[model samples]
Target: MALLGIIRRWHLRDQIPIREIARRLDISRNTVRRYLRSETTEPSYAERRSVSGLDKYSVQLSGWLKAETTKPRKQRRNLKQIHEDLKELGYAGSYDRVAAFARQWKAGQTEWVNSASKRTH
Candidate 1:
């Protein structure tokens, strides 16, 4: 790679063809061009450090969400009730956050079950 740097310098100072530098360096012509043209940079990806409150209670919440689906239709678990239940089960978090998590969890499960039911019929 350092040999490429020397070849690159020679090309710059002598106005030699880029193909000459690439062939002597034993690298692709496009790679030589990109190295000559590009600035050093870092790439990044967006990721959360942690899931909000759910990280602590995801397993319990998932179990409750599944239970809600398996219950009789008339006795479906509501967000407020789930929040209360979570509180009773040692969740030391805000009710609103728990309720929000329940809503999203229930929505996803409901969609899955509804799709499966349609497929069976």
Candidate 2:
């Protein structure tokens, strides 16, 4: 949105040419033209559908995370332990991938809990 505003200001208000705007912004002239021509305030992009190696093990990982949440914090297995367990189960992805998935899962869980609490209140 900010970029769109800047592009518009440079072209309409400051009277900067499209070629200059493209050069200053380090974008293609065609892109600058498209941005100027579009009626929307921001450019829209199609959603990407990229697959990850962790997709196959997501259900199992989620189960482990949910089960761990029921245990005492000191007794719960950390992400490293979960990664090793996944390795035993034939997950070939890196520990970083598992960690990222866990972070995203926990975020979603937090959002769900917050929304549920709001509904009850």
Put down candidate 2 lDDT per residue, 1-121, tens digits, no spaces: 8888999999999999999999999999999999899998766779997999999999999999999999999999999999999999999999999999999999999999999999997
Q: TM-scores for all candidates? A: 0.47, 0.71
Error of 2 at 63 (Å): 0.5
Best by lDDT: 2
Error of 1 at 108 (Å): 4.1
> Candidate 2: where are CA atoms >4 Å away?
1-3, 9-42
Error of 1 at 12 (Å): 28
Q: Report lDDT (CA) for all predictions.
A: 0.76, 0.94
Deviating ranges (above 4 Å) for candidate 1: 1-44, 107-121
TM-score of candidate 2 against the unseen true structure: 0.71
